[model samples]
Target: MPVHNSDIAEAFRRLADLLEIEGGNQYRVRAYRNAAATVEGLPHDAARMIEQGADLSELPGIGEDLAGKIETLIETGELPLLEEVEGRVPEGLAEITHVSGIGPKRAWKLYEELGIETIEALRKAAEAGEIRDIEGFGEKTEQNIIDALGRFEGGEKRLRLMDAEHIAEPLLDYVREIDGVKQAIIAGSYRRQKETVGDLDILVTAKRGSDVMDRFVKYDEVDEVVSKGETRSTVVLQSGFHVDLRVVAEVSYGAALFYFTGSKAHNIVVRKRAIDRGWKLNEYGLFEDNERIAGKTEEEVYEKLDLPFIPPLLRENRGEIEAAENGELPDLVQLDDIRGDLHCHTKWSDGKFTLREMAEAAKDKGYAFLGITDHSKSQTVAGGLSEDGLAKQIDEIDELNEELDGIRLLKGSEVDILENGKLDFSDNILAQLDYVICAIHGGFNLSREKQTERVLRAMDNKHFNILAHATGRLINERAPYEIDLDRIMTEAEDRGCFLELNAHPNRLDIDDARCKMARDMGLMVPIGTDAHSINGLETMRFGVAQAGRGWLEAKDVLNTRAPDELLKLMRR
Candidate 1:
């Protein structure tokens, strides 16, 4: 059982949750949480780093004490501290905290008052009308618990796209190394870049006697082999993630890849087109009567159908086929098209790096500019800066810019939108920065009408340049707060304010569907990483993938502009 970075991160996260539910020291709980984020964000495997004698303590937020624990876990495949905490705390209580509207404190309170320690027990209590009798809980809270439980169960069954990548990339590399293997790729929803994936579909082209399937099942992570055949196999990984692999001949490789990498709806429409043209299409090839006509490549198949190649990201049957026919397909935004990032944090707020370090990282990425949008005074938990603190940061940024070269830093603040629709900072304070990214950190339970109006009123301010994570959703963890996005987008367009496609994997807010809506309305969407550390900056690629799925071109993004042009656009 090899320990991957994700494994270490998950262990740390679980330990933190259990400790918090058991009333551990606040700083101790925070250390584990921060360590989890650091390990998870690393581009390379932590276990390998330890093998190479690298000092984990050198990583941001990972102290000498924490580094020792990581090495111990890597060497022994277990963390004694985590085991110790688990022995004292009901492990199920950690899982209960994951439910929407429930935190560690609330979970602990439930356990104390109702003797509920697991989701099932909590559900039973809620259904029996026992939860409302608790001091802080009432009928609405109890009902919300039942609704959130449904979502929690469904979300637990799927893996986030980022997590899937962590598992698939290593496996794909292992498969490609097998004797006689030719080409290998993980298809299905993973290839389409969906926010979540149910399972992985891998396609390969190999020589006649390739031992691909035989070796695939023996990979280091395989926990169970469900089935095995000459050219196909199924296995479940140690992480409980399922994977399927299929091998095909050279001629059918493209067709197999196309068939496996699909939105079912998109595949159905394409198959219909083939049927109407007196041709048959399947995993093997496209056949006309008894002769094969296309399928050596996806482009070849599309060409035979009188259409151009549709990128996998756009193969959702969402006007893509018609667009290809009318020659109106967009040149989707690529990672290279971005000139800068307009939403990031530094140590002034809940970030891991200093301004100079973050700027150097941006310069390394070839970015022309980087925006420093620290939290406003309202986000105290995140060490939000007061008005004077923000003023000092503005000065520090000016000083750093004068000394730095190639990367210009844009001073900005991620101000909070209050429950009554007022910006956290007044106009006097906001006008001092290069831009403002207003967001909602609390009040997620507001009515849809109020939520929409709260955002609409915030946009009325001249300083509101962008709405951060427009929906306040945390993917599987929390559903988006109720709001009429159609009305909000229209209001933003009228006000000349942009909406963010937050690139954080946990909150790919303003998801693909909304991205398309903004595109249709001719609104520019900035792909902000909402990065908290230098490693966090790498999430820009995910945003680009989402943007491509939404049919956006380089011109449809705000940060694609050069520094001067971007500054001009920022001014209302």
Candidate 2:
């Protein structure tokens, strides 16, 4: 058996919990949390070392007393300390201690009184209104548990991208501050800039990895420790999302990160390239003759393999490696190149800003124009406008256009494509608008074929200038309804309608892959930050970056055109 430090660390972890129950120093109790992290991130097995005659005291977080306890376990095959505590306190009580509204003292009280040991029991008590009558838990507290129980019962524990950032950003900086940590980068979907993230994956390089993971598990934000092992540690944040930290040596930092933070397919292509050139690839690096060579940074990894550094989004294995090897990778888009937003809503619909305020904010960002695409009448829930409402809004747009010198206000509507694929408004109404981005707001359950046909019909609509949020994926939660993207792209190419890359994080439609496919068909894409508020406009940066991953150039995007040119293209 690889002497599992996690098994040993967990034993000590129980004592640490008991210490909290006995009202021990908060910092002393924190030592066990710290030890858990240290054990988790050590690249080499400390338990094996302890078995091989290395003292546990040599480990950074394991103190003399903790070391003695580890020694005792190695000799006697049992931890008297943890077993004694287990005798007094019920087994698995620490596990129950993580319920959101329940603290350590309350958890101990439950064990001493009601003998609650699992989420099910707690839910039953709370739902039966037994918890509200507990000393510290009030009606509000009881209600909070009831709600959290619904979440707990559902077996869903992922964090939203926004929530993950709230925690990961600070810890990322803190890990960098540690003296031994040479490099750290966020891997996984967060790095891909997905609108929704389940958990955060962080990769770090350190001379003191054992010390680092120990410090990491106590990340001030971590509410519960999940597992700790050498070179890896997993923890649950107060928000109930798990974050996995992997520690590698400084020398292999880049290669390890590139491998671990993966879309999987991207790594396969890169490794195939190495094999073609008589090299083997792994987290450490490309190796030949048992001698490590190639890659100290992500850029170096690509350069050594003779290719461009692929961005996280492009790493989805969409022929980028082959294209790069041939020196034919399309010029990817960049954040700075974006100069305008075309799909935005205003208070006229469900947007938070007025038309002028949204436009002026665009101007401040140095954009040349703003397209006000408020929801059309079919979207009643969003206060979608009728013909007269649109006309009134257009008048305000005209007035705003006059107030600005160079910037133009586009009179546009995100008209609903009724189930049959027709625009919400009549042709006369559509003709009066500068552009129409017809979208699907309902009929989410349509079969893939019907959905494709529905969108195809809208794409061929003479007045429809863009097929907005094609597939309509809400990232992490909603699977985009199946659309024969081939048919939609084919129809889009036949007509001159631009494909909308809705830049709202929740809807970065035409995602990275579809954008490449569309560009391959010579269809122009318009990367629109479907900005509904000033802050929403910031998503344009990711939209642009996502396009870059697909090797998109400015010419490939319809929004890159000047107002007159864009108007002409939309009219086409």
Candidate 3:
């Protein structure tokens, strides 16, 4: 099996986590973490780059030593350094970090101080009243840990939707190569564009002579074949993602796709609708009196049900069926409708690229504007810019905008919203920029009332124009800090400020439901890549997918407007 970029990135990340746990040199551990981020966000496969004799070290953060490890991992599916560290570190020590409230330092402390290495041991200690005795942990923290462990226990490992796409897209491409395959699409939550996916369901239509099932189980990435039949098969891929494939006749293709691409609740509604119309709907076709009425296409299937074809992303039974019936379905935002990206970083902060390079990349993608919202000084680890440093960077953006054509660079800062609801930079400094993207960099542990007040107070700042990643979530990694988003949305509406749908795969904050809430509240939610590197701009697709699921139309997004109009809107 080919070693994917995700594999190499995971190896580097593990090495970093283990090194951090051991209190290794900060720079060395940071280098590994940085390399992991750089490799994971690459637009092309790192393994393919190595195979083409391209220099891996040319990529950002990849020094010669790290490059060699990446090459070794890709070539042999193992990293020697990682293996050596795994031997020294208790393997389960890493697993402990998966619990919500227990970071690496805490995990290491639990292991050394309490002899609690595995989650089982940690749970026992927490339950036994021993965990609260630790220097920093209290009864609250101990209970939180126990609650987190309870959540983790018996949980099925799931991948972020984009990660599933990483495996699914390539697998679908391979399946399409079968001689008789006519159509193939991976369905289920993946098709619905959920933020995370449990597994994949692939539906295919092929000619009578196809051997697609055999081809599927024989794919190079298949770790094991769970089951197989002439028309259906289940296999676990090397990445531990389970995939099921079913081939249907051309006449039944649409019905199978609709059945398998369901949120079970949504399917139930559709089936009830079919029954109301004296029709039977199943994987085979939509039938009346045992005679097929429609099945050849999804459009036909919905047409028979007296509804227009619903986009897969909006088929969550969340008022979509009702909306379709009432002719109130939204025209969800599209990738092409995006006119600019308003939140991104550069080497001025923690980004890998320079201002001009980022501008050029956005321009290449047909964007009219790109906002340089690099981190402000409170985010020390990202090397946030001081006020003086931000002034100089703003001047550079001014120069770049003049020299560049077809794209405008907006001067901005991702200023931290401090604990007391103060902006990181002075109002005078913040007002000089095109806009301000205030965010929470620290103090994620505030009370629900305090957190909401902090954000609302920040929004009240005269310079505040957008809230970057409003929820501060890292998907499965960290839960959103306790804040009343309903209150935040109301405040944003009153204040004329917008919210961001941070497009980074790991931080698709202001989730689909919130996005829908923003739309209903008449808030302008722009999709920003928050790109640290040029390649990060490609993450816009995920954000667009997320927005579609949220039922956002082009008009609901601020950046969908032309540059001039967007500037005016942001100022509102």
lDDT of 1 at 281: 92
The best candidate by TM-score is 1
Displacement of residue 326 (Cα, Å) in model 3 is 2.1
- Per candidate, the number of residue pairs that clash is 0, 5, 0
Winner on TM-score between 1 and 2 is 1
- Residue by residue across 1-572, what tens digits does model 2's lDDT show? 12244445556677777777656787778777656544533333455577578776766556798788777765565888777867877665565554444657887776666768777787888888887777877887788666645433223535434445545676799888876887788898788765557787889877753388788887766788899887889998755667888887767777887887787888888898899989998989878869888657778888888888777766777777777878777766777677688988888986767887888888888888888999999898678999999988988888878888767789999999888988898888788889998888777556689988888877667898898888876543355665788888877777877788877655678877777877778888888877656666766876786677666898888888788888987787
Candidates sorted by lDDT, best first: 1, 3, 2
- Cα displacement (angstroms), candidate 2, residue 237, comes to 2.1
Point to the candidate with the largest lDDT: 1
Stretches of candidate 1 exceeding 4 Å from the true structure? 138-155
TM-score of every candidate relative to the true structure: 0.96, 0.68, 0.96
List where candidate 3 sits over 4 angstroms from the true fold: 97-103, 136-155
Model 3 / residue 460 / CA error / Å: 1.9
Query: lDDT by residue for model 3 over 336-382, one digit each (tens)?
Result: 99998988999998999899999999999999999899999989999
Tell me which of candidates 2 and 3 scores higher on TM-score: 3
Error of 2 at 453 (Å): 3.9
